[model samples]
Target chain A: MDLVFFKIALALYLGASAGYLVFLLISSESRASVGFWCAVMGFVAHTLSIMHRAIFSGFFPLATSFDALSAFAWLLVGIFLLVRYHDPSPIFGSIVTPMASVLMIFGWTLVYQVTEPLIPVLRSTWLPVHVTLALAGNGVFAFMAIGGLMYLFQERLIKTKRLGRLHRLLPSLATLDTINRHGLPFGFFLLTLGIITGAFWASSVWGSYWTWDPKETWTLITWFVYAGMIHQRMVLGWRGKRAAVLAIIGFGLVMFSFVGVNALLGGHHAFQGANRFMPPSGL
Target chain B: MEIMVIGLNHSTAPVEIRERITFPGDHDGAVARMIGDVEGVEEAIVLSTCNRAEIVVTTKDVEESRERLIRTIGEIHGQDPSVFRSYLYVRHGADAVRHVFRVAASLDSMVLGEPQILGQVKEGYRRATKARTTGPILNRLMHRAFFTAKRVRTETGVGSAAVSVAYVAVELARKILGELRDKSILLVGAGEMAELAARHLNNQVDRPIVVVNRTYENACILAEELQGLPIRMEQLEQRLVQTDVVITSTGSCDPIIGKAMMKRVMRARRHCPIFLIDIAIPRDVEPDANEIDGVYLYNIDDLQAVVAENIGERRKEALSGERIVSEETEKFMHWTKTLDAAPTIVALKEKLEHIRATELARLNGKFADLDPAQREALESVTRQIINKIAHDPIVFLKRTGAHGKQNLYLDAVQRIFRLNGAADNQNEGEEL
Candidate 1:
């Protein structure tokens, strides 16, 4: 049942993403409206799917890499819909829905079935709290990066004076800048809480508050990058292209810590016994 | 009645000729009433703008009305009929309907997708209505024209882009800054073009316009006029750091704001984006300053280029707008044809009813021996027979009317039924 809902959500998201892509080319209100309603329906199915997984698995769904990625995409779509409700601009939808679809595809294809019960350390109460906060923070960071990319795109077009179709399709530089400004501190705050919770979880499980494991180290590195961005933006007033560039860089570090550390360098945080489900051929 | 339009627009006449024929200050509805008084014209509307002077009317005789209308226009404007006769272009029937739709849609505008023409047409219609010069035909046609214009506006990108230089500057500013409500504008040296652009920006943004000039007295004068602060030329860099948009049109032999100065200002502002519009002939701001990050510089030529590009886009959109106009024109023409067929249909029904009544009267003596109920049954049966016989001809007339060649069908129906005498009497009662 969970798999069915997930497949439905993924298909709807792909349909919505295609609608947004067409909206970018044609710039029609009807296309944007179709994309928005599809996303709304997809989000409903995604919520139901996540709930189904949590209830059936007898644990919080974020115990595996697949669950974490799916939760990240769900949060991204939720935030996007909420923001779109306030702004009503389809340009952001064109950027966000495609990314959400890709994330859902990765979560679906790589791991379709729930593995055996969580390993002993992962069964603690901190499992859901730590992963939820961390994934939520990652979701907001992803949005900030999208805003940053759009800012740079619009800024470059304006600076170069090449007012083409994309130039007209993209939102204003200040709007994209404002998105980064609002996203940066909130994302940083969530990330800080995420790190604090993860530290507590680590201490409870591994008998230490801080571990120099590659995942932990890289997460700290990502945290610091965002912290620095927040400091520059709030204190020094680094905005526009500079802030956008840093936002993209910060999200890069985020993705690297979220995925790369676990895959490339196995540590205490890595799913050691779950290696069978890691490769696509395992399906 | 047939619809006709007799007018001289920017394309048909020189500005001098157009200026000579305008119907100015018709506060008492005198112009519309005068046009309505023309021979054979039943309803009339006079649309007089600087670019065009048009008289739209519904009349029985198109050629006679056209000639009389041209003469009336010359007489009203105090010119001989032969003086500007060659300048007038006349369209009648379906051609006239298409012209009105295109004009309302702004496809026939001096600037292809301009918005002012629609409002002007609405105002003209309102005046004609007040004068009681518009009947059902003119009222319906005007409403259809307004609807077509609205459809063209929303369904196409015809009137979406900014075409003027000042408006283009505002468009570019909004694209960059998102909103200008809190942003400040700086006008350097206070030239006419700079003031015009500043005024355009002032309408959108609620910010004080700072005027900076080489002479303090001149700066003070401009600031007072603009209701803003006046600053000396020495404080240009300080103001540049504070202002989000700077419009410079100074008469300087060399650059007033250079790349180095702009770099310092950008740093002082912590890299907040700024837009610089230089309309000066010799260029008040150095072109190299555009290379700096977050600094968007557009000169007069660049602004004109953007305007030209937007105009090109509107022209492309106008192609779709023309399609909409043609489609609506066809629909409106169909409706008018049905309107033309209405009288003939009514006359045919009346003709059949007359025959049914006369045949029943002739057989009344034969039915006198029957009871009241039997007599009523006989009358109902005869009426049903006549209606069944008339149905096919009535449908044929309406179908052929909407498909064009309405006059031929209408004439054939009238001649076969010998209903022309009845139709002429019905026409008088149909007039408003």
Candidate 2:
């Protein structure tokens, strides 16, 4: 049933992504409503799938890379759809739903689906809290980066003097900039909390609060990059292309922290028990 | 009655001729009265904007109304009617309704999509109303024009983009900065285009404008005129961090704001986005200055290109506006047809009832042998049979009437039904 729900969600996301693409091309406001409802339905099915996984596994579904990415994608969709509800702009879906779809596809293709027994490090009560906050932080950055990309696209169109259909379809530079500003501080704060909570959990389990493990180091680096972005925004009121660039860079760092450290630079965070370049294989 | 529009717009007449044909504000009601006094004209409205002078009217005779409108307009402007006749373009029936819709939608303005024409039309309607020259047909047409204008405004981006370079600058600033309510503008030197941009910003942005020029005295003079604070050119570096938008039109030999100086300002401002409009010949701000983070620099060519692109987009949107005009014209024409159909349907029913009453009265004595209930049943059965026979012709007349062949269809229905006096009554009601 969980897999069935997941499949349905994946299909819906794919359809919604195409709808948004059409909306972007033609700049049709009514088609945006179609895309929005598709996202909403996909989100509902995605939630049911995640809930089913957690219930059957007797834990949150952050045990494997596939589980982590799928859950993160779900959260990202939730955040995006909620924001769009408050502000009805389909332009975000043009970028975000595709990103969600890609993440889900990657989860299915590259990561193992089987739930493994928890290691001593992952068995503590603090595990769920640390992982949830950490994943939530990445989810926020994902949305912010999408908004940043739209800002860059719109700014380029304006700068190049091409006020065409796509240009009109985009949200105003101010609106995109506003989203970046609000997202930066909120994502930064959550990332800070995640880092702090992880440190506490690590100290309790490993007898040290600070570790130079590759995953921890990269996550910290991701946190600092976002911290810098927030500082530049709040103290300097810095925004526009610069802020957008920083956001995209920060999200790239987040990707590296989530995937690169596990796959390329194995550390205590590795789930398959060793650093391997090959995809994890299991039902 | 027929709807007609007879006038000369910017496309049809020279500026001198258009200016001569306008109704002065003091004599706003005079032109309506003059057009209303013409024979065959039932209602008249005179809309005299800077680019066009139009006389919209409803009349019994379309050709006669057009001639009288041209003659009266010529007489009022102290020109020969023949001199103006060549410049006038006339539209009647459905074309006239479409013309009014397009004009109200700003599709017919000298600058397409300019919003003032809608307001001008509404003012014309007001003047016509006050003059008591607008009857039911004109009133309904004007209301639909207003609704069509609103629909065009919302359904398309027809009147949304800025067409002028100065307005484009303001539009870009608002796009980048979101709102200018608390933002500040720095006017670096002064030029006509730069001043126009500043004025446009001042109207929408509730912020104090700062003027800086190489000559302190000139800066002070412009500052006083614009109700802004004046600063010397040397102080530009000191005040650069506070400015959100900088319009530089200085006659400088080289760049005034270099990339290095902009970098320092960005660092101080913590990278708040600043839009720089360089309307200068040699460029007051270095082109490389725009490459920095949070700095957007648009020169005159860039701004003009943006305006050009927006105009193209507006033209594309105007296609949709034209479709809306056609749709509304069809709808309004159908409504007028229904107006004609209403009285015809009434006349047809009355004619059928008249025959039924005369025949029933003649049969009353013949059916007197039956009881009262039986007699009533017979009467109702005969009545239903007559109604059934009349239904098909009545429906056909209404359907055809709504398509504007009502006179032909009504005449045929009356002659076939042998209804006397009803057709004449319908024609009289239509003329009124």
Candidate 3:
């Protein structure tokens, strides 16, 4: 029941993302209502599956890093769909939905390798709080990247005067810039909190507060890039175009470090009990 | 008081006059200061961008304020006030308010749906607020304009497609290369158009920008502004091999980077594609340079074709943007209309409350000696009468006044009971 609901939820999120992308290109008003409702349904399904898994296993469901990542992406999609209701610019999902899909897909790929026992190492009271915050931060940064890319693209199209068929559906560089402006601070705050809680968890386990691990370094770099982008935007009066591009680029860096580093690199941040990298018994 | 707007926008004024009077910053602080000094101007804001200079003011008499404002703005541009009198437009009452809302929402921008106007409006309001001249009335209108601007952006496709010629140049490069960060862009001349194309490259990636110009100083200046490095025109041959893109717009009679140099470039770069944009009129680079392998050259005519295609999309978004403005404006006007009646309604309600309470007090002592049951029943009957009396008149005032028929209805209610009696002491609720 748990796996079935999880698969259904994943399919819905991917479908919603594709639906929103189509709506962005053709931009019918009706498509927006469809995308928003689909995302909402997916979120409900995701939450149910996670709860069912937790109850069946008799723990808070922090057993595997991949499972936690999957849950977080689902949460991000839910939050993203809600925010999109308020500002349904196609560029938003252009940056956001990809992050949700990518994280879930990566986690799903490791389904066989990941281990999730409801033991003491994964049973800290702050486990849910820490994981939720980190994923929320990821969601926010993903938006910044999208807003930035749109800014750069919009600036170019305006200069070239070659705006084509789907061009009319894009958000204004100024509007994207504003979303980036507000989105950065929110993303920064969440990532900062996530880092702090992760540090607390680390101390309780690893007995060290600061380690220069790949995950730690990359997340910090992501933080600093956004921090710089926000400062350039607010205090310097960077306004629309420049600010937007910076946001998109910043989010790209975040994704590269998040999915690429975790899935490809066999660093300390990889799933603790990952068997995927191990050689096959016969081979 | 009437809402008054008088100034020249991109449609009415040229860039020279706009440049002179633009409140791009508190840059000169000239336009902002002059608007405040105009007589009968209670609250004011100045919105000046490359395309327009507009002054939105809350005033007692728009005609007088209009004349004064144009004169002051014209003076700032060192023109005789009468010369620009023909170009300046004057909108008053609801029209003036609607204009500001539309302009701030970017429905009136030169590009139709460009989004910078909202930030520009915010900057103007911020400056006015700093000067302490922008109070509640201007604040409310300005804030409503901002809300409308946001709605236009999200709910409508006001600024969707790339419209301007300069932006089109940059977008084309992206489509060809996938990403521009690591690519090399070479500017062939020292012209402003070349500099503009470079600015569009921006800080998307960590790649360096190279500018090769005939004049070292011009290249240096542009390079400094864009944080790029300058290379001399002598290196044109060598640079072409390394450069991925070349943009040329110059006044020179002959081609700067011709077919010979471009052919050499194609072979050296190993058939790596390059984009050549010629914006100059007499043709800076030769047209046949495109015949060479891996050279994707676009002249002004090709660009215009793309611009023509963009027009239909821009036009479509323009209609969508306009629809958004009309809907948002109606919603805002509804609020203002209701607000216009609220003060008098409050005063009328207060008068009724005072009379009802006094009559209740008089009856209170008279009924004190009666039985408790009898007093309670009488009080309930009196409360019901007060409700019935207040209901019909209040409902009548709200319904009639909101639909542009407030004058007679307001007078009738005021005369019947001499209610809102102090209305004569101040200006009537109708804005001039």
Candidate 4:
């Protein structure tokens, strides 16, 4: 996580995303190689960046909601890029890169604002541990979210009989279906542990175990939505479009839960218990 | 150099014939044994997949190698070597290189630049490696073939479109029906292409596939392979009524799917679209059946039109790929040549060193007035001068003699150096 490595990673991420888009238009395999190595370099950089942050400060770097989101976004993008690199089945930056670009933008613009949260809660030992786990869980969920959304998009094209160029680029329904099944459950398990830890930490600090806080409530809702998606897909022999649609909906809920709960809704955990990054109009 | 390709392609033989000639899975050991039995075959590998079975062998005697290969494989399948040889085509040197590149890139495949050929080549390389059948020559060749395939994909748009008929059928089905899993695929006349199309559907769709052919056993074979059910031709109408897609590649002389017959099936299905693929030479479905409502009819002409379009793209891309291959091939050859010349360059340097040592040893006493340290310094200077003199010849011999002339050049250089008279005697006596 040297500053040089971090800078190099950011450069690689930018290059890879651009390169993949170029290849998509030209339909060239040479750029795929460029795209793949760029991703590898970017992944190395992202990992180092996190490690640097961790070593510089005796904290997990997810001290605030913004820091948490950025790390989570990076984790999700890294995994997606690696999977596409190994599979080489045309699932590239089309889905994952845009998501990474947005998260990085948000990470840079917003996270720096909360550098001086003069509160004991922000300084608590449990804050880093709980938030780190939560963000990591969120990262896993986001991966599932993107994959599920792509699955949904592909299924829609197939259902409509359009058979566009995109259909040719995307993976088979069977592959998409399996990816969703494999990813979402792991995401759910992480989120459950994350929520439980958060509840315990809240009880210790705020003298309450069950608060109808926006973040907690939204997380609960996201959990239920995913739970329902998994149920439909596994038990009902539901596959492809119907299953993909549900995944998309669940991920949409997760997205809303992620930003809306922080930006608009008020809670003890909201904005990492700091008002500097929060706008004047508080939720 | 010998180059031989044994077994059948789509044009030279049918699926039944190719299947008979094709080896079982992971047969590199068997193939290697066969190649070992062939006189003068230095290396061999077998590329086996659904479309083709090709045996690539490298040897000094092309005619004998070809004969042995044909005889062995023919005997394996109880055929005369001459009969099988007539069905096989042999190419040597650059033609062999081009053929393998084309095959690995799917350009030489029946389906024309299909994606599966790359995977098949990988499997072939893997199996050959395991069996130790592939030596350095074919090892380099297969590896280059992969690069050629990659070059074809990157430099050309040949692989941009779905050229394979199986994929084309899937594309057409996707365009017409949308999400094949919800719709049933009724396969008639267990023709290889039709069965391949069905297999593609089976992987893509969730809907139960029903294959009804005239031969129940052929239908069963296709069904077992794809996890589909084999229904008798008697049940064709009943199944056709409910099915969304129908591919017919039967050997019927007259139309099995007559206009009146399809009309009743369409009515029974409540006007759902029924796709008919007439893959047979004389055509299986009637020409009039295409006129019916919600019926999409395509005979061999339509299939060929798609093939023509794919070929059009391939022809354009083939030129670009060939350019890339030409450049890459030269680059690889240059690398190999440089490596080959390295040993000669080393040996030539050693010979020069030996000459310099002998002359220095013989002449050292003439400069007796010099101190020991001064003599040592002179020795160092002589060695440096010898190195400077030897550099250009080493480069020349390495570059020019890298291929076939290196041995002759090295021998000539050794004679000029009197290397045999001095170095050989000195080395043997030094050891003693």
Residue-wise C-alpha lDDT for candidate 4, range B194-213, written one tens digit per residue? 77777887788787678777
DockQ of 3: 0.06
Docking class of 2: acceptable
Computed on alpha carbons, the lDDT of every model, listed in order, comes to 0.83, 0.81, 0.68, 0.68
Question: After superposing candidate 3, which stretches have Cα over 4 Å from the reference?
Answer: A1-22, A26-44, A50-283, B13-41, B49-51, B60-81, B174-183, B188-241, B248-297, B341-432
TM-score of each: 0.81, 0.76, 0.52, 0.59
Q: Per-residue lDDT for B262-378 in model 2, tens only?
A: 999998887777899999999899999888877889999988877887888889989999998999899788756644656667767887778888998888888779998998898
Stretches of candidate 2 off by over 4 Å are A1-16, A40-71, A85-90, A105-131, A154-178, A195-218, A227-242, A259-283, B23-39, B42-46, B72-80, B122-156, B267-270, B327-432
Higher TM-score: candidate 1 or 4? 1
Chain A TM-score of model 4 versus the true structure?
A: 0.84
Pairs with backbone N, CA or C atoms under 3 Å apart (clashes), candidate 1: none
lDDT of 3 by residue, A1-283 (tens): 4577777777877777777777776565556656666667878888887787778667766456666677667767766777777776545554455666677777777643324454455567656777677767877766666666765676565445445644444565545656676888898898888788878877786787667767778878988987887787666656555566677677677766655666566466554354335310100
Off by over 4 Å in 1: A1-5, A48-64, A114-128, A201-208, A268-283, B25-45, B74-79, B128-140, B340-432
**Which candidate wins on DockQ?**
1
Winner on TM-score between 2 and 4 is 2
How is the predicted docking of candidate 1 categorized under the CAPRI scheme? acceptable
In model 1 chain B, which range of ten residues has the least summed lDDT? B423-432
Docking class for model 3 is incorrect
lDDT of 1 at B411: 59
lDDT of candidate 1 at residue A163, scale 0 to 100:
74
Candidate 3 predicts chain B with a TM-score of 0.63
